[model samples]
Target: MNRKPSTIPVPVLMMIGIVAISFSSIFIKWSAAPASIQGMYRLLFTSLLMLPFARPYSGALFALRKKDWIMLIASGIMLALHFLLWMGSLKFTSVASSTMIMALEPVFIMLGAYFLFKEKTAVSALLGMGIAIAGVIFIGWGDIGISANNLKGDILSIGGTAAVAVHMLIGQKVVVRMPSYLYSLIVFISASFVFAIYNLLMGIPFFDYPPREWGIFMLLAVVPTVFGHILFNWLLQFVSATTVSMNILGEPVGASILAYLLLGEQLTGLQWTGSLLVMCGLAAYLYAGRKKGKDIAPVLDNAS
Candidate 1:
């Protein structure tokens, strides 16, 4: 008889990865670079950092099929767009507004799966999504009614959320057929090309970024983008999108705490309460779904 390998629980891995990714906002804020410049460096540096590990010329990256290449490039461009929009949001609106709105990416994913892909959703997951959305609503309310001056930031954040949703859906389809590291390599390489072209067209100075800025950018590429995403992509091998979405409840909480500690950003009591509600609902959803054993949703196999 063949033996199956025992694996670490997927939820634990997802939690850790999501927590690591949450630190990204803190690093970006600390860097204090322009959003476009930050977006450019993020892809460029992450590509360089990951290339050594992925060994793209070892026939790994090129081994992908034509269709896979298409999806990989699309996902990469969408990721670049997400980074650009969300980072720009920082300049226009409060962090609370941006994080809260971007948190709705999962909701968009759920909607897309239902309408676009015809994937079935569990009642528990739906309920959890609803409760989590309420928490988001409260957080958004807290951040809203600021000056109309911040409207551009709010719009950018929403656009970022849409980009994120598209990226996740496309990735779910692409990742199963290839190793996550290779998939990430293709995506990052494509995104770097897009950023390079955009920087050239905009006449933005892409080089000679200060050393301190370069150091921060390097940390950003290594820590959140490389480590966090690698782990998250690995978790997808064992987990469902709903499971991943549930884990996202931690991002805002982790971000809020880090912001307070590192950036002197304070959270109001209401925001804390809202954050807690998000966690509770996500916990309930995951628990209920996993108990049924049919928790993992069906991903579209055709993309691979």
Candidate 2:
């Protein structure tokens, strides 16, 4: 693939996106609203905030083909399913089991991308993925529980990972065909719609949250949804979906640091070691990409 470097390197941008999303857990912890309700409002606010900036692509957005709309909607639903399934899993299983399973997202994405997009990853990159996944397993190893009770949660987490992998693969297809923000706008709206339906079905109050909760929702939208997810969405046009998914491994590391400083949570020795391994794996992955040439491809100027 012929490519040119962007103003900022892909690794740096990926780091920034990871840091931005690291705030998501903190914000969620601070909020008191139902999970689906918080998700609905966060997505709703993100789409609304993106509207003004998307004016330039308004015409192209409307001109999107039927297939584009179908893919976008399917992508959005998968994203919502990810949240729903992951959150539901937490209630039934240990956090360690759930998180460790969720960390397999990149593997799921890698397989899908390989088959569907005909993308091939290098041996070093696959090794990097293995190391990163090993790091995650180690981070949660102490608390991992295997029991009949945990089976359901494990399955749910697996489902969630699959859902997100599909969501990412869809984004890889759709984001390249149009401007990123415009593509994300439709996805955010579609996801918010799904979340709204979930909220209604669960009988979660829509407007009963206090100001603090609202503030948390807004922060969720701005930080993670826009800066985190939208940034990742924008990145899909340049990098392979598996590469983007691999970058997500950094989120747990970032979140652990933030949890330490902000939430007064203490990191165990295993966590510190796990974080180191994750960083090393990411470094190796970047090296593999660089070795193969084409770090960040030049954006195709297709407004449609």
TM-score versus the correct structure, for each prediction:
0.79, 0.75
| lDDT for 49 (candidate 1) | 74
* Model 2 whole-model lDDT (C-alpha atoms): 0.69
lDDT by residue for model 2 over 1-304, one digit each (tens)? 5555667899898888888877776676566676677777877887888778887898888888999999989988987887777656655554444554565665677779888978999999789877866765555543343445556766776788888888877887888788766776788789899998888888888898788988998998888766776677677767775576555556666766776687665545665565566566666766676688635321111000
Which residue pairs clash within candidate 2?
none
**Candidate 1: stretches off by over 4 Å:** 1-19, 56-60, 149-154, 231-247, 288-304
- Model 1 earns a TM-score of 0.79
**What is candidate 1's lDDT per residue for 241-301, written digit by digit as tens?**
5565454556766677777787787655656566666666667656666776644342211
| Candidate 1 structure lDDT | 0.68
